[model samples]
Target: MALIDCIVLALYLIGTLAVGLHYAGRNQRSQDMFAAGGQSPWWVSGLSSFMTLKSAGTFVVWGGLAYREGVVAIAITTCIGVSAILVGLFVAGQWRRTGVTTPAEFVELRFGRAAVQLYTWAMMAVRIVSTGVALYAVAVMLVALVPLEPGHPLRDPASGHLSLAFAIFLFGAIVVAYTVAGGLWAVLMTDVLQFIVLQLAVLFVIPLLWLKLGSGAPLAPLPPNFFSPTSDQYTWWFMAGWVGVHFFLIGAEWAFAQRYICVPSDTDAKKSAYLFGGLYLISPALWLTPPILFRMLQADADPEQAYILASKLVLPAGMLGLMMAAMFSATASAISGQINVFAGVLTEQFYRRVFRPGASERNLVAAGRWFALLIGAALVAVALLVPVMGGAERIVLTLTGMLFGPLMAPTIWGLLSGRIGMAAVTASAGLVFLAGLWVKFGLDGPLGSPVLAAWVQANPRIADVLVGAVLPVAILTVAHLLRRTPQPAWRALQARVDAYAPTPPDEHGVDHAPAKVVAISLGASGLLTLALLAFNRDGRGALLVFGLSMLAIAWMAWRVSRRRPGPAN
Candidate 1:
């Protein structure tokens, strides 16, 4: 990396930190800290939700898959959009209607305190460790771009790069600091900025690569199956199951539910989710193309590094730093979003509800900050240990498969149908858990039946979907139908939700400060892109396009900031 690249990256990190610190004093209560005081714009929440779903895994895991399998990766990932649309249409509004401060509170209402504890603790266990794995992956990728000389103080002598441990700690601390300082506001603003930078970086890559490849001729040599949407392991069945899994995930998962709850109204929540769905539906082609085109350039390139290598091949020095910043933003968006949600849950559900029942809102906010620190520390520790755990990624995938179906499916089912009680949730999840264990450990294992093993081998990706997604949902529905008794708490909550009506949210109050911040940040980024033309001439055309785009969005944001409240719809 050039000195200019380093400077650009430094500026981005500092700017993100500044944004966080800027909001430090704005959150006077736990609600403000955790959910932006229900004042965030629907679009902001929507974009944050989308960013929360990404991480370095977008580049490493999905990008690699795109490199090897062509368009199948997009087909698989587009399931996220399909799931989001389903949730937007059926579930997001329901969450907002419940008027719960956190998903844990909803769990407590629909099920019971016991279920809340079960759901919260289980989610934390799986999500925190997986978050650590993502953090580690980000560090590993970024550290590769920061090479060091033989005698450099920060260099790892053995591997001849910046020390991996140091890189992890550095990135982890940055995320934790910003998250602790600004809370949800920070997460939302940074996510919007990240989205802008990511789009600019990727949009530039396409035309540049096209010019290099000289149109459609170079792509002709690729294998025929490369263009097929359903490849070997990622079959249509797997994609359908993926959609089911994410539907539950986005619908009931605390992080995503936080997005719904944080918005102004039920309608806003639906809008946010719909925006997420719309973007996911349209943007995967743009997101996956750089890596796909890179395959034509170097068929033997490391799949995991396809995105970085492709960008590095075409992007000039300062723009490469912008790309790097965008990549870091992906992981930071996810990690910080999770930390914020976990802290909010711990603060609202445990700290205030159990220990300090009469605690003031300020006190609750302080406690939430402390909880954020604790969670961030734990996540960083997990990342440090990921190198020792060879199967960390696999562990995340397996746990997500096993847990999302048994845990989240029942939660979403309970949200939509009041027939199922806590007992039903327990029974459904328990049965699925047992079946999932048997499938994973018995049939898929060496000591199990040879016939079953062969079947599992033949349908490698199908078993998890069947056991994890399809079976749990089916059981939950059956259990709901069989239940003869109605639960009072569920009925009561449903009555409250049904009776509630929302007044128009104050447009002047909603995201007033965040809007200006976004405008200024984007405007500054646009200026910086234009400034790069003075130093590098080879990439002038791409830089101009990026600069103009950022400037246009910044102007729109400025207009939004200055708009007066109109008649309520």
Candidate 2:
């Protein structure tokens, strides 16, 4: 790597730390710390939501998959956009209207304290593992891009585990610093900036590759099944089933839902989902194009290295540095969101509710910070151990599917329906867990049912969709109805909804500081981006496009700032 690239990376890390520290003092109260006092602009929350879903793995793994599979990959990506649209229409507004800091708190409101505690611990486990996998993905990319010296102490003989551990700790520490300091405010602001950086980097690469490929290039023939959506592994039935699975997963994804809790109004929450959906509709094409082109040009290329190879082949030195910085931004934004949400759950749902019900706001905030550190440390430890788990990414996805599969039905049912007994919810969730485990692993391993195991292995994707989502939802709905559960009166449920409504803002006092900070940060990032482009002779066209985009962003930021609502009580 060039000295200039190193400097750009350092500056980005420093700027992120500054953003976190800047908001530390202002987040004195629990609400402010956990949910940004419900004052975040819709766009900020929206971009953060988009970036949370778009992790380092999306660039490396999904791009690689797209390169290998062609249009079939695009079909999988569309599920995410469809899920976002469903969330916007059915889930986001309801979550924001609940006035809860964390989804666990909502569980408590609907179910009982015991249910909330159970849900919190379960989600904590899932989130920790998920974040660790995200860290591992980033570390893999780092080791590939920035090689260690042959004799370095942290470089292992046969593997990059030691270097991977170091990279995880280094990046994890930076994420903890800002997330703990500024909480969601810092997370959202940094995410907006990070999202911009990632978009510009990928957008810049796509056109360069297109121009190169269009200039009378002879491409190798694709694999036989490359464009087919119905391969042995991914049948049309399997793909259709996953659309259902994704709908449930999107509704139950806690980190994504946390964005709704952060915004000021239900309208903003819905708008955020819409914004995320719109981005999903377009960004995947930009992200996947370069890798696809790389595959076309280099038929025998390593699929996992598609994005990295494309950048190395096409981007100039200074531009390469910016691209690396963007990759780091993707990882940082994702891990920070996960860590912040975990901290919120630990502090609000566990510590404050269980161990220290009468604890002061200051004490709760301090606990949240400590929780952030603890989670960061755990993620680093997991990253170190991840190398032993062959196919770690697939394992993480399967684990999350099993973990959240059962809970989805009960969660949505609790929100939309009344008179759902605590017993019913608990039993339904437990049954789903058992069912998912039986289909996913128990039959294949512990149960030792060769016939069932063979069937499951033959149709794994379909099994996941059925056992993980559809069947569980159906089972839970049947149980609820068979019990003849009697819902509360409509008026009674309406009263509870009203009670959870947002507190009225102060009439005279309004804070513009957050909006100002966001505007300034966006402008600064734009300048930094321009500076990086100026250093690259081939980046003039990219610079012009970036500059115009930044101007549009600045204008939008101004309008959002002016329309910013006063602080929630």
Candidate 3:
């Protein structure tokens, strides 16, 4: 990397740390520490949710698919948007109205304490794996960008492991620093910056690539079946199954569910979901443009490296650094979001609830911070093993699919229906896990069953869809029938919900919702991004504009934070 590029990247890292530290001491109570005291504006939470959904895997994996398969990949990717719409319509408002701090708390409300405890631990494990996969993906991208010699120590089999481990830890440590310092406030604020950076990077690439490759001149001919839906590994049936998996995944995913609880009102929660859906709807164009262009130009390029290779080919020195920052931003946003929620679960669902019910607010806040560090470290360790696990994106999808599959039916059912008992829900979860494991791994372990393995192998995709969607619903239905217990009425549930209403931090007289500051930051950042796009001809000019814009946004944000109340206020 050039000296200018390294400086740009270093500045981004410094800015992220400063933002987190800027809000570090403001969280006086557990609520403020965990969910920003439930005062986050809908738009901020919405942008955070969108960025959380977009991990570095989205860039590497989905871009690879688009490069290999063509526009059909866009249709498959839209499942995320469709799922977001479904969540906004049905789940978001209900989550906010429940008044729970974490999704596991909602499990306690809807089911029982035992169920919530089980769920909290289960979700923590799932998130750790998911975040680890994200870390690994980003580390892979970073290593790819490094100009390693053929026999470099970092590329040697023995020392390459050390290099990979170092990359994972480096990424993890940076994310944990900000997350532990500011909690959700820092996470959301930095996420807004990350979202802007990532969006601008991709948007800039599109026009530049177009002008460079496919200007007014005639484009090169596409490969055979480039425009066909059934051209590649993604058949219509496969796409349908992908949609089915995400439909349930999005509705019950803990990350987005946590966002629903971060807002002041149910309306705000719903609006965030809607905003998330809208962004998902349009994000494909920005995300897929470079890869699509790559497909048309260099037909033989490695599919998974489409976006990275495009950056190398199209972006100049400073702009390439910005794109690298964008990649780091994607992974960091995801890791921070997961770590924040993990800390919440640790403090609220486990630490305070079980170990120290009488712990002070200060003690609990301290515990949450410690847990964030612990969990972040654990995820880094897991990421070290991801290189041997085939592909980072594939591992994430398969693991999350199996883990979240069974939980989805019970979660959605428990929220909407009031008649299901805790026992039934818990049992359904166990059965669904066994079923999903059989379909996913096919009894390849000590408990391997030859017959089941053969069946799974013969119809892998079909079995996946059945286990992920059909089997869970079936188990839930049977459980509901076998245990015909009437749950508490919705009125009673609402009463329980109201009891957990957020306590505003007005005694300090701090305006938690600084709408004006958010507006100024976003408006300034957006205008600056436009300026970079317009001034693309001069690399130095674009770099100068990006730097000044970041400085201006940071100054405005710092000023707003100074007005907010502190611990002693």
Candidate 4:
């Protein structure tokens, strides 16, 4: 890496910390810290939610598939878009109508406090462990790419790369500091900034690679099946199952539920989800292009590293730093969202609701910050221990997938059907848990028959869908039908949802502060990029185009902040 690239990377990290500190004073109440006081614009929530899913895994995992199997990666990712749309239509508005601050609150109202306690502990464990695994994965990827000077204190002796432990700690500390200090407001704003950086960085790669491959039939030599929508390994059934898995995830998962809850009204919640879906639908063409093009350039290159290698081959000195920053942005966006969501649950669900019912809002906010610190510490510790855990990450991932049905089915079903009482929820979850164990252990474990295990190995995606989505949903439906009676809690909760009406848009007006912050940050990034024209003579056009794009979006944000709403009908 060049000195210019290092400077850009350092500045981006510092900017994230500055954003956190900037919003530290905004939380006079717990609502302000955790849910933006329900004042965040729908667009901000939408963009933040999208960034939460756009992690470094997108590049490492999907990019490898793009290199080896062309358009199939795009199809797999587009499943999330389909899920988002379905969720918006059926689920997002329901969350807002409930008027709950957290998903745990809704769970308690429908299933009793016992369910809340069960879900809080169980989901927190799953989220923390899974996030640690994600952090560890990204750090390992970074250490392979980032080299250190000979005999440098932080360099690995054998690899001459940055130490894996240092990479994990460094990125972990950055995420923790911002989330603990600034809360959800910090997470939202940083997400917007990171999205811009990531989009611009990848957007630049397309033009550079295109210009380099001037006038050639670059894709002619590739296999004919490379362009097929469904590869042999990722077939049509797998795609359908993949879609179902994400539907349960995006429709009812706590992180996404928080996005729906934090918006101003049910309408805003729907709009936010729609925006997320639209982005996923439109973005794959741009995000996956570089790796596909790079496959033609270097057919023998390591598929997992194809995306980063493409950037290194084509991007200029300072811009390579921006690309590296974008990679960090991917992981940071995800980890920060998880930290903030769990912190909110610990504060609102456990601390205030159970331990101190009469605690002041100030105290609740303080407790939230403390909880954030604790969860962040735990995440770092787990990430640092991943190497010694020996396939523990894979185990944790499988466990999380298995639990999704038990966890999400009850919550989503409760929203739509009053017939699904706590008894059904408990029964379905127990049955589903046992069924998941059978699938994972009885069919695929070492003790299982080799023939069955081999089939599961070849079609793991279909098995996951059956165990995680199809079976739990079936159990819940059957148990609810057997009950045939609505609980009093469901009736009262349904009454609240039906009777609630949001404040009129004209009366509530818009909160322009977030838009203003976004505009200023984007403008600064644009001006900085434009200034780099003084140094890079060879890449003047790419810098000019990207800088102008940033400024254009910044102007749009400023316009949003200044605009006033008309009177409502």
Best by TM-score: 1
Q: Which has the greatest lDDT? A: 1
The C-alpha RMSD of each candidate to the native structure, in angstroms, is 2.2, 3.0, 4.7, 2.6
lDDT of 3 by residue, 479-536 (tens): 7776555677445776876675543545655454344435455555445444444435
Report lDDT (Cα) of residue 100, candidate 4: 86
Alpha carbon deviation, residue 223, candidate 4 (Å): 6.0
TM-score head-to-head 2 vs 3, winner: 2
- TM-score of every prediction relative to native: 0.95, 0.91, 0.86, 0.93
Q: For each candidate, what is the lDDT?
A: 0.85, 0.75, 0.75, 0.82
lDDT (C-alpha) at residue 479 in model 2: 64
Off by over 4 Å in 4: 215-224, 385-401, 444-451, 503-508, 564-569
User: What is the Cα-based lDDT of residue 523 in candidate 4?
Assistant: 91
Runs in model 1 lying further than 4 Å from the true structure: 215-224, 391-396, 444-447, 503-511, 566-569
- Candidate 2 ranges beyond 4 A from true positions: 154-156, 159-162, 215-218, 228-230, 444-451, 487-494, 500-503, 506-515, 555-569
**Model 4, residue 237: what's the lDDT?**
83
Candidate 1 worst ten-residue window by lDDT? 502-511
The TM-score that candidate 1 achieves is 0.95
Give the per-residue Cα lDDT of candidate 1 at 64: 82
Q: Where does candidate 3 stray beyond 4 Å?
A: 148-162, 215-223, 229-241, 441-459, 481-485, 488-492, 497-569
Residue 61 shift from truth in candidate 4, angstroms? 2.0
